[model samples]
Target: MKYSAIITDIEGTTSRISFVTQVLFPYAARQLPAFMQQHASEPAVAEQLAACRNLMQQPDASLDAIIAQLQQWIAEDKKATPLKALQGMVWQQGYQNGAFTGHVYQDVFDALSRWQQQGIKLYVYSSGSVQAQQLLFKYSDFGDMTPLFSGYFDTRIGAKREMSSYAAILQHLQLPPKQVLFLSDVVAELDAAAPLGIGTMQLIRDGQVAGSHTIAHNFNQVEELIA
Candidate 1:
C-alpha cells in the first residue's frame, strides 16, 4: 500500500452529507431539550454542561437556558466541543433505540474492509466527538464497522482547518506524514494536512469541490488512487 495509515473524515467523505444534515442533526436537535432535562444531574452530562456554561460565560446558567443555547448552537451548526459531546450522548440513545443506522457508502465500506485486511491502519478524524464517531460505525447501515478502525479523533486535538491538529494526529499515530493519507470532502481540511506532508484526497461525492489534492467521487476511486 502506498499509505500505511488512512485517517478519514466522517461527514461528506465516508458518510453522506444528508444523513448528517437531514437525519442526525435534526434528531439530536429535537432530543436535546428532553435529553438535557433527563441527564443534567449525571456527571458526564454535567461536565459537558459546565464546559458549555464556561463557553457562554454563564457559569450559573439554568438548565433551560443552556438547552436553548445548545439548540441555537445546533441551528447554527457550530462545532462547539460541548455541543459535539452532547450530540454524541444523544446519538448513543438513538443508535441503541434503532432510531437510525448511520449511512456509509457501499464503496467506502468495501474499500475500508479491504484496506484493513491489507494491514493499513484506519482512523477517523471528525469535528464530531469520538464517541459519536464510534457510535456511527458501531451501528452503521453496513453493521458494526468499529472494529476496523485503529483509533478516532475529534476537535479536542485542534480544529480540523489548523495544521497543528494534523501534526498532533501524526504524533499520536506514530507514522510519517507521507505514509498517512487524510481524506475529506472539505478542501480546507485537506489543505491543512497537505502542508504537514500528509497524503491528501478530496471526496467530491455530490458536486465539484475545488482543490489541489487528488479527487475521488467515491471510495473505489480512492482505492484506485492509492493502489
Candidate 2:
C-alpha cells in the first residue's frame, strides 16, 4: 500500500521453478554449443565469450572448453553473469525460432496489468540476464507483457543476496528503498532487500512458507498486500 515501485523475481515467483528447470534451462543447455558456434564471430556473442573466459580466469581458453564450462554451469543453475548472458543469447534464438515462449502464471499477468493501471512501476530482478528477462515478458505464454515492466535488473547489477544490490536498485530507481516492494520466493533475497528498507514479500507457490519473509500464496494475495 505504501510502495511506488514493485520489483519481482521471475523463477519461482512470477513463474514456476519447474518451467525454468525443465523447459528454459534444458532448451538453453541443448542449444548452447550450436548457438555459440554459429554466433562466435558476432560482436555480442564474442563479448559474452570473453566474459565467460574472464569468469573462468582462463584468458586463452578454447571455444570447446568454454562451451563445456557453460554446460556445467547450466547444470548447476549458477547465476554467474557470463553464463546468464550467454543463456540469454541462446534463448533469443529459440524465441525467434518459435521453439518456446516464456512462461508466466495467470495470476501474475492479471496482477501486473492491474498494478500498471494504478500507476505502480513494475520492475524485474532476476538471476536471468536482463535481455532474457525482457524477452521472457515480451514473448510470454499469456502474450507480450514486457510493456507492463518499467525496467529489468539482472546479476550484472549484483548478487541477489547482497544488500548492495538492493541499494543499487533503489539508487537507480531514484526512490527511497521503503518505497519499493521486493518479491521473491527466496528468503535470503528478501532478507537482503529488507535490510535496505525495501518491503519484502515471499511467494509461497511451493507451499513452504515457514522461512519466508512474508508469505503470499499467489499474485492475488500479493496484490492485496500492495493495495
Candidate 3:
C-alpha cells in the first residue's frame, strides 16, 4: 500500500448522496419530531436540545419550537453538530427497528475489504456524528462493515473543509502527513488535506466534480491511484 493510513468520506464516496438526501435525511426529519417529543426529558437527549436552544439563542424556546428548528436544520442539510448528534440518536432506533439498511456502494465494499486485508489502516471522517457513522456501518447493506475501520472522526474535530481538521487527524495518527491518504467526493476537502502533505483523491462518482486532486471514478480506481 502506498500509505499507512487511509481516511475516506461517506456520502458520494462510499455511498450514494441520494441515499442520504432522500432516505436518511427524510427518515431523520420525519422521526425527529417524534423522538424529540418523546425523549425530551432524557439527559442525553435533553442536553442536545439545550445545545440546540443555545445555538438558536432562544433559551426559553419550547419543545415544539426546538423541534421546528431541528427540522429546519435538516431541511437545509445544515451540518450543525447538535443536529448531527440528535439525528444519530434517531437513526439508532430506525436501524434497530429495521426501517432501512445503510447503503454502501458495491465497489466500496470490495475495495475496503481488499485494502484492510493488505494491512493498510482504514478510518472514516464524515460530517455525520460518530454514532451515526457507526450505525450506518453496523447495519450497512454489506452487513457489519464496522470492523474495517480502525477509528472514526466527525465534525467535532473541526469542519471538514478546514485545514485544521486534517492537521488534527494527522496529530492523532502520529504519522507524517504523506503517510496518510484522504479520499472524498468534495474538492474543497481534498484541497484542505493536500496542503498538509496528505495524499488526496477525489471520488467523482456522479460524473461531476473536477479538481486539481487525483480523481477516481470508484474505489477500484482509488486503489489504482495508490498502487
| Off by more than 4 A, model 3 | none
Off by over 4 Å in 1: none
Q: Residues 171-194, candidate 2: write the lDDT tens digits.
A: 899998888999899998998899
Candidate lDDT scores, in order, read 0.95, 0.90, 0.94
Q: In model 2, which range of ten residues has the least summed lDDT?
A: 206-215
Using TM-score as the measure, what is the rank order of every candidate, best first?
Answer: 1, 3, 2
Residue-level lDDT of model 3, residues 90-186, one tens digit each, is 9999999999999999999999999999999999999999999999999999999999999999999999999999999999999999899999999
TM-score per model over all chains = 0.99, 0.97, 0.98
Best by lDDT: 1
Which residue pairs clash in candidate 1?
none
Which has the better TM-score: candidate 1, or candidate 2? Answer: 1
> Model 1: per-residue lDDT, tens digit, 16-57?
999999999999999989999999999999999999999999
Candidate 1, position 177, lDDT: 91
